[model samples]
Target: MLKNKFFLIVAILLVFFVVYYTFFGGNTASVDGLEATINPATYGRQVVEKRTEKDQFLRTNAESPILDKASFRGLSYFAPDVSYRVVARLEPFADKTQKLVVSMSDGSEEVYEKFAHAVFSLHGEACRLLVVKLENTYSILFRDSTSGKETYGGGRYIELDPKQLTDNHAIIDFNTAYNPYCAYNPRYACPLPPTENKLPVAIKSGEKYIAHE
Candidate 1:
């Protein structure tokens, strides 16, 4: 009787294992479904470097900067804290365009304008341009610098709150910038970064291409 009970228990455990694997294990259909949703090919092409625990913690928990009153093209503003690394450079723009004009606050002064054409990336996606001046606000623009070559050519962007602009400088990390959903799949219509926003540098930080074997 003791031997029979042991055998029964063993058989039951085996059955449970089989059921779990069949439902949620490495089934081909399940894997295919995941790929269909996010396009593993595009994901695999990306390369994401690991971040230090301190940097990760800061990125997730840092408090956003609060500005008294920032406006771009007459729009209200709110600033989002960005942090990224510089990458490489692309081709220069025509007409000997060298730098991009950036406005920052220097604490003592109310507003300070400077040029920073040397935009870097955390990943392959290069930054593109799309500056729009709406009623009371200005639309901050950017795009994937490596669209066709390394990343999605359609590109990605971040919206800046003009109200947060201060004399003090803000961190613009390319690693934090990401591609839109359309880059992974063709079911969405994402706005492409305009030509003016294109940075002539290669940003090699942030989330990399997702890959699956």
Candidate 2:
């Protein structure tokens, strides 16, 4: 009888440890908490759920690409006349030069003109810089940055779409930046932002990195 009781006690303890480790004892929980605090609208519960859904979609879907080809056939707008520069290199994870492109936009009719080059840190990893001009807007894609640490590791992406690109004006807002689908799941191969796209300053805007359960 005593032996049976002892075995039962051991089993109970094992179950408790498993529960703790699976839920509250890992980095997953911490990431969940961060997502909750950042997403005030859903009150945090939906953050994990949304991430899960995105992961599932990326894993099962096969048509998504790292960078979607831009359609600028009908776009006609002069470049913006904005003067902005990267004040710092928050983190670098690529081999190419970092740059900042500012658009001259006044709320309506944005335009992307020139890009200012800057230095970046590779964060002990190697990456490449890809510059693609689509339609009337320009895209800078690269990998390796504070994105995984402060943002998403799969890398964050910023674009100056036609709507935001106007004559001598562009709407460059970090808050509007977002993570690619690959950030949620490893199955997806989203394009990493180029080193040139890395901003020297901390863009405290846009979506924050999320942790999956």
Candidate 3:
């Protein structure tokens, strides 16, 4: 009888421990846990981290000739700013066949459909950008007043997730803006931003121009 009682006590204690751990163990995880991970700082860090990884990848890639032979420490970027992150209204261009001829550095033109426009504000100044569909994701290539002086002369690019657009509103984070490959190598023919995508305000965020050595 004592042996049976001891076995029952052990089984009861084991079940209670399992239940408590199953319900409470996940709380001990990092602050960036499974559900509460979305935040502005997290996004900013992710952008910088992704860019750093990309630069390293480009520097070592055999096919990426831009950084393979060029001696450079790393790509330049403005400090991540949450102010550059804005929620915009995604307005569709009425004309279904509206196409834009984006000039390439190689003196070539790439035809892109202007599917939509993202209208947002920066430092209280109104800004807009043309959106183009690239395969499965939407993208924007734009230039601001800071283009020549701070960012890449050819401007910067940002990709948007179509699935994230809710009720015609999308979050456009300019802090994640990046320069074109042509900025690093002339052999790369990158598409230039069209006239409509130019902003009057200086966007002091994103990748800067790196002169080729």
Candidate 4:
């Protein structure tokens, strides 16, 4: 009798596990091979190198900078903070076709499609951020309290891989946050970050403010 009861309990537990995995766990991408071996420090290093290369390119060929007259001391950035690198849950917007009217620096308006709402934690504070897409590319444009002070008043931007959007996991690394071209030169019309995307904390990572002449 005892043996029979033990077998019955095991079978019941197995069924419960299967149900949970099918509904919830199944939404996440299966971690296998190289992805399982990723190290945070290695990923951080790669991001820093990429940002440096971009700055080099912009300094040489970017028309937004008054390169002919302004003194370029190279771009500035806060040291990469690992705390700002977070894996967020991607919650698809109720209506993918929802549109947002984005304002541009040159007194113009543009439309952006709502992609999804990213639920994530930053500095121990839980928050939800809107994800926007233009054409087939997805990205996040946000403004933090650091803006107009430690960073660009127009806000900062980061690109998101479309593959990761519905994988249930989205990687948001503030270390890659960048200023729009308008931050350097008003000549280029750049989209202003929407008020709904503003954060209350100081995100002291990524690019720093460089006063343009």
Candidate 5:
């Protein structure tokens, strides 16, 4: 009788595991791979706070990219939308030693390694972007359909925190995208987005272009 009860308990546990995996594990693409829980409200609030701090820095900091501090108006931006935050599957390049030469706005060129490809979906469209190792973190230099019309003409950049990335996935938050320093001052040599990194969709989130005085 005891042996039969043990087998019955094991079968019940197996059924529970299957049901849980079917409902929850299938959603791995939506949540941060390292973090199981995602709070949209809190994430939106953090994005706002960071943007506010950036505006303050641009307005007052001595090393700010804005050349005319006195007449400098705050930077423009799209409203924070949590939907722009996406979880991307990171696929490392087969040839890790490959180098990508990118042109700069100042006529110079910068070299970057072809680190990985970040694949994700946004606005019901499949997207893939080239990732590169920039200093200690990873960065994506990209131009979207909004370029030259709604955002900066040259391009915009998004830097991923190395700590936030897992082996196979990372968070690609378009809400944190920003124009390069060259957009504000031509004195700075900023790297332009490569042809492969140009996205076909209109990314309506992140910073917008404001005519500087």
Candidate 6:
């Protein structure tokens, strides 16, 4: 009977820990668990932590996109700014079965399901972007005025966690946008951003690239 009670107590503690972390974890990326009172300093630190982890992975991971790992000096990124983190209202597509075919870097095409339209305002300008289900998670493929100047001309992607969606709203943080693998290696066949995803504004956040030949 003592053993049975101990097992029951352990199970209860495990459940409590799971519930507590799900609601109070300091996961900056997860809008669902992110604290509402997070300040810029804390958010910036969390973003830095994520970037550091990515750098470590790219430097040591065998599957890294960098061909010459010896010369990789880590990726460049704009300063973390909370201003770029905006809450967007997701509008579901009327035709849920809609599929979008996008051109690939290697002269091919890939099909993705139209997820929703993320409507938000950035820098006092109202903007809307098409979100698509690219494999497992929803992603936004976009090209801004910074393309070809400060960022990759082929565009960048911002992946959205399905768990981050709360009441048809999601936090879209441009600071986390990243270049496609093709930016590092031409051998990669990355999907290009559709024309509709192009933005007139210059997004100064996210990753930057300079071709090294």
lDDT of each: 0.38, 0.42, 0.76, 0.77, 0.86, 0.85
Q: What would the per-residue lDDT of candidate 4 be over residues 43-131, giving only the tens digit for each residue? A: 56887798778766766765546444435656788987777866777788777679989999899998999887888888888877888
Ranking by TM-score: 5, 6, 4, 3, 2, 1
Per lDDT, the best of the predicted structures is 5
| Per-residue C-alpha lDDT of model 3 across residues 11-55, encoded as one tens digit per residue | 999999888667655334332122211355556688889888877
Backbone clash pairs for candidate 4 read: none
Candidate 5 lDDT over residue span 1-213, tens digit each: 999999999999999999876665544544444553356666678889999899889999988989888987688999988888888899998887988898998899999888899999988999999999856768999999999999998999999977669778988889999999888887899999988888879999999998674
Least accurate 10 contiguous residues by lDDT in model 5: 28-37
User: Per-residue lDDT for 124-194 in model 2, tens only?
Assistant: 33322333444454555433345656677555555644454433333333333567655544555455444
Deviation from native of the Cα of residue 18 in model 2, angstroms: 63
lDDT, candidate 5, at 150: 97
TM-score of 6: 0.81
lDDT pick, better of 1 and 2 = 2
For each candidate in turn, give its C-alpha RMSD to the true structure in angstroms. 18.0, 17.1, 7.9, 9.3, 6.4, 8.5
lDDT of 4: 0.77
- What TM-score goes with each of the models? 0.34, 0.37, 0.75, 0.77, 0.82, 0.81
Name the lDDT of candidate 5. Answer: 0.86
Model 6 Cα lDDT, one tens digit per residue, 55-166: 8888789988887778877789998988888878889888889999999999999999998999989998889999999678889999999998999999999997666666
Looking at candidate 3, what is the lDDT of residue 183? 83
Q: Comparing 2 and 4 by TM-score, which wins?
A: 4
lDDT of 1 by residue, 119-199 (tens): 334435545333333344433345444555555455545433443222222223354455554443444345555457666
